[model samples]
Target: MDLQQMRYVVAVAETNSFTRAAERCLVVQSALSHQIARLERELGARLFERTSRRVRLTPAGMAFLPAARQCLDAAERAAAEVAAAVGEVRGRLAVGLIPTVAAADIPGALLGYRRKYPHVRISLRVGASEDLVEQVKQGSLDVAFLGLPPTMRPEGVAAHELARDRLVAVVAPDHPLADEPAVSLRRLSSETFVDFPAGTAGRIQSDLAFSAAGLSRDVAFEVTTADYVTRLVGPGLGVAMLPSAFAPQLTGVVTIEVTDAPTRVEYIIWSRFGHTPAAAAFLKALDIT
Candidate 1:
């Protein structure tokens, strides 16, 4: 099958809806369906089981999916190598950034890269570190800035350390624990806490620290952004544990070091293979080998 047909199949598999897949692929539904039908005819098997309510991949489709992805990846890598040979770094670069770690010169680095390679198109996605890492692993993102706990290591990706920051507790200035030089994890077990959502890197580190101290915290508020957590704590809503880099300078909030808190290591991560020339240029701009 042609690369276009393979792309259509992959899109349909990912979206699980021919109509939505067509929309994503920027083609009409009939055209996409025709391609898939042609592909299935050539293979002599049904790739997807279609129903009124949903679409599911058949056994043949499941078996073909990985090979299809590999083929596409290889084609892209070959194109990138060609572009590199010609000394051209012009292509779409999809990069993911974690909000908590986005402040650590990543934006500046991207700006410089854009200035140096104006023809290169860049798309930036902001999300939780775990989600961003997943995007990188899935090949949707060329690279990602992630905040990882020291105890948690990523697999199947190349991680370059960007920065290391400690986790700290934030509270209202008049709060009972605001004056403390440092707070232990066990001391905040009973405190009402504002925190990042579950499964995020920040939340994972906080959970692990509490669990390690044999203490549990009552998370009264959960937000997706560290800035919002800081704002919430500023209004005396509750205390929060966030990366020290995200500690805000708001009027009512005070940051206290967590004596036993986990270290949040920021990393620039990419897939082990198939990075585009633009991605490599961006990494070079960031001083990553």
Candidate 2:
């Protein structure tokens, strides 16, 4: 009738003695007898034939015994699986990153995270900040690295400022301004600019910088990735602004500090859905405040 009743029946069938089976089940013999009597009465069939000397299974008991054992076995396995999922520290986690962060310095952080948490599998996806933020909000990603403007937090998501990287002017080595220690926004205002796409964090930063300097920027091309923007600048496609951390790795492009640009805050974002241990561990590797 119920799992406990089924367990009693199976235990009695195995031990073939009410006294000993109740001992194995940790119930008094009389309590065991009452439970089995209730089960047999509900089924309207005798489960065991009893004698003064011993107990033996009835034909119905022989047919039902294996099924009862199988049910208990399945319930046990389900409980164990649920416990493992709740308490164990191993599973797959999906992470997203804006192209700028992935290009600037994520590999070393990820390598350290993987070394410490070897059991956790991690997959990396790269996209624009807007796309990665949407992925985290929609639960398609466990966490993401993105640049955050001062007032753009979405509901049901939490973000922490992980690091800040400075934006600087990027130009081909042969460009006249490339030799300067710093480039003023006024001097570069009319130059063709390779810009980040609209609605992205980098583009917003560029817009703010131009606004601060009272200059209007001329857009030559729109790009989605920092690496591509730097590469394009090297070929004289246009001048660009990029995070200074990308300077050492970029070939043929010279980066000069933008005298008036503001520092951008890089963030680690996750849905309110709660971060997995792997994502949390990865955040720790960044040493984020």
Candidate 3:
């Protein structure tokens, strides 16, 4: 019938005495007796056989005892799971990211988080800033990294600026422009460029940088990944522009500072929906506290 009735049935079955069971349950003897009687009536079966001096189980009581105990155990487990989902720092965490952040400090931060909490399951997804935002909003990801432009405000999601990585020019190690210690947008106006697709976050940065210098970037290729820009540049395919951090890991590519006033802002973006322990730990290690 109810949890109290089930508990009374278990107590009576274990103690085999209404008086002792009432004492164990911290209820009056009459209350315990009434609860068990109500349960038997609801079940349409005699659960206990009682004499003036002794108490024993009917076939029904024996059958019902284990099920009653199981119900109580299940109820407790449900509560524990809800609590774990709310506050505990363990479980599966799906993270999404824009290319630059994924290629930079995020991997190292995740490695540190894995060392600290080896049991938490972690998964990563890569997309543009706006796409990652949509994934988080749709519950496809728990956290993400983004670089929001001045025109964009991350809606329905929590965001924090983790770092500011300046933009740079990347070229094949032996390319003529690679010899410059640092180059300006004016110097790059004539170079064939490899860049992000027309309407993505990285492309917005490139467009803004060129606009600020009143120069047009010559387009020879369009791609989606920052790493591909590196690999393409290695073959002297064309010059690429990307975040400075992204260039460090790219062998056969030379990184030169873009002598421009504007730099892209890198951020640790995540859904306001919440974070699993592992994702939160990785964010903390990134100094996003």
Candidate 4:
């Protein structure tokens, strides 16, 4: 019924444990439980189903959660706006990025943003492209960096296109294909591959390219992080196709230009409604708008 009660509910839902939620909110478990119980009584609905081992949101809780999150966001945005009026940007900035983000220098950008806006608190998460986009749209993240096939664009949000590049094949130094300056999707398709899991945005770019060429790849190793792919390929276990911008950063792999490769477009996305003061300044710091 109140913001504090809603915060407790949100925390409990996210952490999936009353004890952990209490720790996150810097309160004791009993007080947090009492507040949520009081709120549930006021709302005439049970928000969570509790058990000895686990906590799960009830139907009513799931229904209440989105509005509760929006209310919280509104309250935070109001305070941020007041600070903005005084030419100060002090608030939480939650940023999400794909691990292979190449269009912008993420760590360097955060360093500069921190130096310029010392009052703001910042947090970062690395996730899949689609997951980051959804987090930005859901109000969990203020901004995100994403990369997808050039044919697609993030829907229902405001995004700035950062750059685009074709993917390159990476192989070990003594691998048969390593000496080649250039290869084709078809050529790479014949080798064992290490790649992101199937159906992920990063994985799909290569999947579609080979599918279109009427070829199939043998993805022997499925790993989430690009660094893992590099490690796998470094031992001559399998080959990987990575973004041109990203491939040069690795030391063990030899980058061979793919004659016919999938093109990926990088973007910076934020809410379409408006930017929070911290997000606005951060984007502006990068000359995005």
Candidate 5:
């Protein structure tokens, strides 16, 4: 019935626990529960099914969540628009990026944005390129930095190219390829490898190149984080191919050029139609059109 009550319900649905939702909403458990109970009574539906160990949304809650989120977004957007009309940028800015992103100094950029727009709320999420792009498209993230193969493009979002670079092979010091000045995919394919999980944007870059060369390699370890990939490679267990710019940042590994290396492109993506004032201002401040 009221925004506050709706917020409590939404928080409970998201967190899946009344106690956690209360903490997120900055209210006591009893008050949040009472408000949501009153709202449920007014609507003639039970929103959540509570158990001793967990909470789950009921059918009615599932149907109500989307509309509740839309209402909250609309209210926030209205206030942001009013502030924009007054030459002020004040709203939430949720940014997402891959952990291996090096196209921009994300931390420094966030620091600058915070300094310039002290009234805005800023949050960051480090995740996979695909997940980050999807988050931006869904409007949960105001902006995202992504890395994908040159042949790929993010669908249903506005993106700007940041930088492009070829990949290099990383090997442990005692590995056979470490002493080599350069190597080919056919050579590296014969050795076991450490790489991102198959089918991910990070792994696909190398896969495409090997496929183009009519070669297949074994990924002995498939890890989500680049640091883990490097850590595995450092033990002489396997080799990896990583962005040329990012390879130098990791130690205990020798970086070697690949004759037919795959190229990766970095991009910054945002919602085409759902740009919050804070997102717009942050982009403008960074000279990203």
Candidate 6:
């Protein structure tokens, strides 16, 4: 019935134990259980199925969970807005970044943000662009820096394009095509390639580029990190197509421009729901608004 009860229910649903939920909410287990029971009675349905080993959410609980989270988020946003009206920026900001993006200016912007709003707590998460975009849409991340192909745009979020870099071909220095000024996709079709795993933005862009060029590569190594791909290329394991910014500076590796390669664009994405004070301040600091 109240926000406190909703918080307790959400906590119990997440932790699956009354004791753990109580610990998370900083309340006594008995009081938390009593509050949840009162809520269930008021709602006329059992929310959680409690057993000796585990607590599972009933259908009612599953249906109510999303709304409860939305209510909590709305409450927080309201508080942040009130603080903002007073020229205050004080709240937690959850930001996500794609690991392969290397915008050197971001660190300086973060430093300026820290100096201007020292009380604002910032948390950073690194992941694939697709994953980070999903987190922003799901309200788990306030904002994110994502690398996506120019043809694609993330849905359900406001995006600001920051920068675009060309995809380049990387190979070992001793390789035949290492000294080339630019390499065509068709020429590398027969060569073994080290690439990012499927479903990532980088891999998706690579696949699209190869398909567009009527070329197919023999991907010999599939790794998660861009650094790993560069390392493998340095050892002559295979050639890789990577964003120019992510190309490594290894002694045995050389990066060549990829002819007709797709441009990887970096975007700053935020939830369509209004920004929190801290998030707004960060956007201002980065001159993104």
lDDT of all predictions: 0.85, 0.78, 0.78, 0.92, 0.92, 0.86
**How do the residues 1-289 of candidate 5 rate in per-residue lDDT, one tens digit apiece?**
9889989989999899999999999999999999999999999999999999999999999999989998998899899999999999898999999878888889999999999999899999988999988888888999999899999998899999999999999999899889899999999999999999889999999999999999989998999998988889998989999999887689888999999899999999999885988999989977997
- The numbered model that scores best in TM-score is 5
lDDT of 3 by residue, 97-191 (tens): 87777334667767777787666677999898888888777666778888755545678888887666777888898989878888888888889
Q: Give the TM-scores of the predictions, in the order they appear.
A: 0.80, 0.65, 0.65, 0.92, 0.96, 0.85
Cα lDDT tens digits for candidate 4, 1-289: 7899889999999999999999999999999999999998999999999999999999999999999998998888899899999999988899999988898899999999999999899999999999988888888899999999987899989999999999999999999988888998877878999999998999999999999999998998999999999999999999998999987688888999998889999999999988899999999999989
Colliding residue pairs in candidate 5: none
Clashing pairs for predicted structure model 3, backbone only? none
Per-residue alpha-carbon lDDT of model 2 for 138-243, expressed as tens digits?
6668788887555455346787776677788889989988889997888889789998887677788878878877789888799887778877898888998877
Ranking by TM-score: 5, 4, 6, 1, 2, 3
Per-prediction CA RMSD (Å):
3.4, 17.5, 16.5, 1.9, 1.3, 2.8
Question: Per-residue lDDT for 164 in model 3?
Answer: 69
Error of 3 at 204 (Å): 0.6
Candidate 3 CA-lDDT value: 0.78
Q: By the lDDT metric, which is better: model 4 or model 6?
A: 4
Candidate 5 at 223: error in angstroms? 0.8
Model 4 global lDDT (CA atoms, 0 to 1): 0.92
Candidate 1 residue pairs that clash: none
Decoy 5 TM-score against native: 0.96
Residue 249 of model 1 has an lDDT of 39
In candidate 6, which residue pairs clash? none
